[model samples]
Target: MKNSQLYKGSLNTIILKLLEEKGRMYGYEITQKVKEITNGELAITEGALYPALHKLEAEGFLEAEVEKVDNRLRKYYKLTENGQLETANRLSELEEFIRNMQTLVHPKWSY
Candidate 1:
């Protein structure tokens, strides 16, 4: 498993990107999907996940819906209109950062 610091900075971006791709997702579903996609190399703890989610919701970048499923409430999150735009912007920023990091750290590779 990677260190928390390595994943910490990207948590919000990761969540935004996932929501952008998946439309809407519940918390556990998000955690599982991330683990699946990363082949279990990374995991999102409730400690980290909930705060990021709550912050995004508070910042108007996400909206939530609550539904009763199997005698419990499940809160699902989706991007707002502002969030859709922010997704585009954040994605671009992330991509650009990746490119820059590659240039610095993997300069021998040919893209």
Candidate 2:
């Protein structure tokens, strides 16, 4: 990410939203998807990605399944029931945050 701090707080939400859309994804796929979606403005690093994935899995928001693809094992993540609900909630909160930031950054004038 060009301004990782700006996006850091929303990483979990971002992951949730992606999994919700893609159904399931492995770690590297998630990283590449984010980069592709953002036209490379955002690059999710393994250092940042795995801990968040582990945290979400521990929190019951995600579940992982490992599969052998070719000769390597790939762990994929998908949203749990709770995760689906949480995605809606988090998306609402993120949208509101963006709207609030927009208001602050580009306020309308009242005469």
Candidate 3:
């Protein structure tokens, strides 16, 4: 689904979940991971990603650390305690959303 507009609210949830699974990741890594998982259907742009990461950090949902890789300083993000809690909530919400969508799209199909 190219150009399948992602809801802005779910952005944080997606980032938090990814960080929870992968431990720590840099900006590029985060974008790549999402793209990989979605099979190139959903692409997270740097513009959207950086602001979300910063917002999460500001909200105490994440922590950042800097590391040197190949003579470049890369900032890595990891979930905080609050982030863990947020991840659980977000995942549940995402699941519910998917279930509701399935019900709407396949009203006569029983699974």
Candidate 4:
């Protein structure tokens, strides 16, 4: 993202959520999808994206399959059983965070 620090903490959750929605996606596909979803406001760099993907894979939250598509090999990631469960938890946490931030940023006026 343009403001990386603000969004860095949520990267993993974002990835998991996207994978949950897309079923399976390659790294570049994930990056492009996020760009498309956010209308280019957020851009995930390879430096950031790969590590998150690797970490998720190591945590058993994702599974990767390598296949030769057309001419080049592509790695596709799909959510595992644990990932499915984690996605729910991550989304819930993210929703709560957003609500909290909203309250803090725009508190209701009381007389």
lDDT of 1: 0.92
- How many collisions per candidate? 0, 0, 0, 0
lDDT of 4 at 56: 99
- RMSD over all Cα atoms, model 2: 1.0
lDDT (Cα, tens digit) per residue for candidate 4, span 1-87: 475788999999999999999999999999999999999999999999999999999999999999999999999999999999999
Task: Please give each candidate's TM-score.
Answer: 0.92, 0.96, 0.88, 0.95
Better candidate number, 3 or 4, judged by lDDT? 4
- Model 2 Cα lDDT, one tens digit per residue, 1-111: 465699999999999999999999999999999999999999889999999999999999999999999999999999999999999999999999999999999999899
Residue 49's C-alpha lDDT in candidate 2?
96
For model 2, the stretches where C-alpha displacement exceeds 4 angstroms are: none
TM-score of 4: 0.95
> What lDDT does the true structure give each of the candidates?
0.92, 0.96, 0.89, 0.96
Give the per-residue lDDT digits (tens) of candidate 1, residues 1-111. 644687888999999999999999999999999999999888998888999999999999999999999999999999999999988998899889999998999787668
> After best superposition, candidate 4 residue 71: deviation in angstroms?
1.6
Of candidates 4 and 1, the better by lDDT = 4
RMSD of 4: 1.2
Candidate 4: minimum summed lDDT over ten consecutive residues — where?
1-10
Error of 2 at 45 (Å): 0.4
Q: Choose 1 or 2, whichever is better by TM-score.
A: 2
